[model samples]
Target chain A: MMTARAAFAAVAFAALALPASAITVVVADGAPEIALRVGATGGTISQVSFAVAAATAGTGTLILGTTNAAAGSAQAPNFGTACAGNNVRIWARARSTAFSPRTATLTVNGSGNLTSGANTIPLTNFGWVTSGGTEIASGNFTGSPTQALLSFGTTREVSVCKRFQFLNTTIYPSGTYTGQVTYSLQMP
Target chain B: MNPTRLLASLALGAAILATAGPVHAEQPATDTTAPFAVNARLNFRLTYPRFLRFRVGATGATVNLMSFTVPAGNVGSGTPVAPTGGDAGGGTGVNVLVYGNNGQVTITATNSSGGLGIGTATASDGRINYNQISSVSSSGQLPAPVLTNAGGTTALPTLNSTLVTQRTAVWTYSYLNQTIPSAGTYGGTNASRGGRVTYTATMP
Candidate 1:
C-alpha cells in the first residue's frame, strides 16, 4: 500500500507539472489582468486642452495649454504611484512556462477621429514619447487598428511613462474635441 | 526508490509550483491559455476657442500710406491715378489676409471724416468724397472691403460656412478721378483728411 507521504508526493508532482498562464497590464492602478484591457476613464485616462489666444499667420504652432505648457500639466492616476510630473505611466508583465524567449507585443489604436458635436479632428494629430524601463520610443497615432507600439521578450516586465502632444497644424471648428485609444499587450 | 526520497521530491516540486502560481495570481488576472493579451485605454481632449486675425496693407502697429499724384494734364480728366508707397512697393496693390476659425467674417472700413479735406476746407469748399477711392482684388477669396463716406461692412464669401475661413488677396487701389475740384493736396499729413481708413474684421 502507498504511504501518506507517497500520496502527498504524487499531488505535489502534479501541481509542478501544471503550466503557467497569466499576463498583467496595468495603467496607473487599474487592473487589466485576464483580458488585459485599459481605457480613457477612471485611472486610465490622459487628457489635455488647448486654448489659443491668437491665430498664427504663417506656420502653425504647437498646441499649448496654460502658460504655454507644451503637453499640459500631468495628471495623477487614481490608484498607482504617479510618474514624473510630466508623464503618464503604464505597467505590463507576462509570465509563462512555455519557453524562455516568448514574444510580447504592445499596440495602440484610436476610436476614429476626435469629435465635438459636428466638428472633428484626425486622430493622427496626437503623438507621444516614452521613457523609463522598456521604452516604446516615439511615434504618432496612425489611426490604424493595430499599430505596433513596442515588443519584448518573454517573462519581461515594463514600467514606462509616455508624454503626449498635439500638432496644431490646421484650424478646425472651435470646440472641445475628444477621443479615446486602447493600448493592448499580447504575449505568445 | 526509497519512500522518503520520493515524498521529498514531490513536496519540493509542489513548493516551487506554488510559489510561481502565487506570484502570477497576486498582481493581476491569470489565464490557462497561450498567446495571452491585455489592453489599457487612454482618453484625450482638446478645446479651441473662437479666433480671428485680419491684416491689410502691412502687419504692424504703424499704419501704411498709399499716396497718389495726379499729373497736371491728367487732373480731373477722368484718368485713373495709381498709388505709391504702402506694402505694394510703389505699386497700387497691397496684401490682404483674413483668417478665422468660426463662422463668416465681416470686414468694414471706417474713416473719421466724410471726405478728403483740403487745407481745413469745409464740405462746401469742395472735398473729394471717399467714394473716389476704389479697390480691386487679385482674387475673389478675399475681396477688398469697399470704402465709403458712411463706412460699410462686407461679409466674406467663405467656401464653407461651417469650416475655417482663411483667405488672401492683393488689393490694388486707384483714384477714380471722376470729378475736378479746387484741390490743395486733398489728403495729407492730417488723419482727418481721409489719410487713414481703419479696417475692422468681426466674426461670430
Candidate 2:
C-alpha cells in the first residue's frame, strides 16, 4: 500500500511540474514615451530635442538602446545642453530566476524638430551623438514616437503625446523602472 | 521583484494595472504676451512788421518894384522932373531947395490906383536937393515898374520906353517969385533946370 501511494504522489508532483517547467518568459514590450515636450508659442520648432527613448522590461534579454550609435554616445554624457549635439538617452533592464537583471541607458540626439511630408513632426537625428567620452554609430533607437504637436500659440502651457518601440542590445534581461525625469532649460 | 527588495517587494499587497503602454507627464503650461505701441505731433509760430515816410512840392513865387519916381519942374512931363505946373517955384515951391520953399511943401503921388508909395517929395528953402524920397509899390496882378534917376529930378523906368500916361505934380512954388522964375532958363531958354530926386525899394 505505501509503494502504490508513493507512485500516485509522484504523478501529482509531475503534473505540478508540467506548468511550472514549461519555460515561461514574461516579456516587457516597448514602453517608450515623449515627456515634458517643450517649445515656443506661435513660434515654429526650428529645432527640437529627441531627448527620451523607449524602455523595456522582461524575463528575457532587456536593453535600453544602441550604444556608440549616431543617436547616443557609447559612454556616460554631460547633463548640460548645447546648441549642437544633444545628450538624449534611452534605458531598459530585465530579470529572471536563472539570469541576472541588467540595466542600460541609451541616448538619442537629433536636429531639433521639423515637420515631415506626413504633416507630423519627425525627429531629425543625423546619426551623430556626443557624450563625455565618445561618438557612436547611427540608427541607435530603431523606433520613433507618434508625431504630435507640442506648441502653445498664446497660452503659457501646452499638451503633447508621444510613443516609441523598444530594442535590446545584449542578453541582459528583466529590469523595470518608474520614471523620475527632470526637465530644465538646456541653454536658454 | 521591485528594484529595492526584489522578491519581497514583488510580494507586497498591491494591485498591478495592465495596459499596452504607460503615460508620461507633459511640460507645465506657460504664458506669452503681446508687444508695445507708439504715436506723435508737431507745431510752430511766427511774426513781422513794415516801414514808410511823407512828402510835398516845390510850388512857385514872384518879386516886384512899382513906380517910385515922378516928374518935378514939369507937370505932365511923364519924366522925373520938377513940379513946375501951377504955382511955379518950379511948382515945387523950393526955390531949388528940397524941404521948404517960401513955405513948406509936401508932394505925394500914387499908381493907377492911388496908394501911398508910388512917389513922394517935400521941398523948402532955395535950391532943390531932391535927396530923401519914398519907395515903390508892387502887386500880384502886374510886374513891378523899375525907375532910375535919369539926370537930375527926371526918373525914367526903362528910359527908352513910351509913356503910358501923363504925369501931374502939385507945385507951391508959385509963392516963390509968385510965379515962374523971371529967368531965361525956363525950358524955352533952359540952361539946365532939372534937379535930383532919390528913391528906394526893398523886399519884405
Candidate 3:
C-alpha cells in the first residue's frame, strides 16, 4: 500500500501530466481581448490633407504644400504629439492565457487608388514611415489586396506612429482624392 | 492521512491546474482559446485645391521692358524690328508657360489705355496702335494669343484631352515699323501711355 505522502505526490504528478480539457469556461468579464485602435478617437476615421503650392520657377516641378497637423495619440516617443508632422497614432494589444509560443500578427490592405471625379492617383503613390513601436518595414502600397505590417508575441502591447506621404513627382488634377484601408490583428 | 482527506487533497490539486486568473465581470470578453482574428478599420482622405500659373517675358513680379529703335532710312518700311533688352532671346523672344489643373485655359491681354500715347504729349503728337506689337510662338502647342489695342482672349488647345493643361513655348515679339509719326517716345513709364499689357489667364 502506498503511504499518504506517496499518494499525494502521485495525485500532483497526474494533475500536471493531464492534457488540456476541450471544455472551456467562458466568462462575461472583459480581460483578454485583442484590440487595435487608431487616431485620437479610436472609432473615428483619420483624415489628412496635402495642399500643393506653386512651383518655384516657371516650368519647374510643383512642390507639395504643408501637410495637416499630426492627430496621433500621446504615446511614448511621440508623447502628446506625432513623431513626424504627418503621423497617425496606432495602438495594438493582445492578451491571451494560452501556453507559450503565442503570437499575434497585424496586417493592412487598401480598397484601391485614391480617386477624384474621373482622375485617379495610383495607390502606390502613398507610403509610410514608422516610429515609436516595433519597427515595421517602411514601404509604399503595392496595389495588392493585402500586405503584412508587423507581428508580436501575445500577451503584449505596442504603440506605433505612422507618417504618411504622397509622391508628388507628377502633377494631378485639382480635387479631393480619397481612399480607405483596413487593419486586422490575428492570434493563434 | 484519512481516506476522505486524501481524496479532498487530490480534488484541490486538479482544480488548481485547470483554473485561470480571476476574470473581471464588467465588460464583454473575447475567448481566444482557438485561433481568432480582430479587425479595426482606418479611412484615409486627401484634399487638393485648384491652381493656375502663367509666365511671360520674365518670371516673378518684375515686369520686362522691350524697346525697339528704327533707323531714319527704314521708316515706314514695314520691317520687323527686334527689341534690345527683355528676355534671354535678345529681347525678341521670351519664355512662356501656362500651367493649370482645371480643364481648358483662356489667355487674354488688356491695356489700360486705348493706345501707346506719347509720354505727357498731346494728341497732336499721335499715338501708336498696339497692333504694331506682334508675337509669334515657337511651337504650335501654345499659339501666340492675339495682342490688339482693344484687347482679346484666346483659348489654348489642350495637349491631352483627358488630363490637365500644361503648355510651354518661346514667344518672339516684334515691332511692325509700319508708319511714321510725330517724334516722341510713344510709351514710357507713364501708366496712361499704355506702357503695360496685363496678360490674364482663366480656367473653369
Query: Residue A17 lDDT in model 1?
Result: 34
Q: Which parts of model 3 are misplaced by more than 4 Å? A: A1-45, A49-71, A74-86, A90-111, A117-119, A129-159, A166-175, A183-188, B1-40, B57-59, B71-79, B84-91, B115-125, B157-163, B178-184
Best by lDDT: 3
Q: B1-204 in candidate 3: lDDT tens per residue? A: 999999999999988875533221211123355565655555556565577778887877767777778888887899978976667576778888887777788788887566453333566777777778888888787877777777644747464445476778888888898988667776655668775677788888
Error of 2 at B180 (Å): 99
Question: Per-residue alpha-carbon lDDT of model 1 for B73-148, expressed as tens digits?
Answer: 8888888999886686356788887778778887877776654423233555567777778888888878777777
Please tell me the interface RMSD, in Å, for model 3: 5.0
List where candidate 1 sits over 4 angstroms from the true fold: A1-44, A54-59, A64-83, A94-100, A129-134, B1-32, B72-79, B88-91, B115-125, B159-163, B177-183
* lDDT per residue as tens, model 2, B1-204: 457686655645332433211222222111111111000000000000111100001112211111122324543333333233322232232111111101112222222211211121221222322222222222211112232223222222221112111112222211112122122222111213332222221111
Q: Alpha-carbon error at B11 in model 1, in Å? A: 49
In candidate 2, what are the lDDT values of residues A21-130, reduced to their tens digit? 01112233232211122221122211222222222111122222221222221211111122213233321112222333222222222323233222222222122232
Q: List the residue pairs that clash in candidate 3.
A: A74-A80
Q: Tell me the fnat of candidate 2.
A: 0.02
Which of 1 and 3 is ahead in TM-score?
Answer: 1
| Docking quality category of candidate 2 according to DockQ thresholds | incorrect
User: What is candidate 2's TM-score against the reference?
Assistant: 0.15
RMSD of each: 15.6, 57.1, 16.4
Position A75, candidate 1: lDDT: 26
For candidate 3, the lDDT comes to 0.63
Docking quality (DockQ) for each candidate: 0.26, 0.01, 0.25
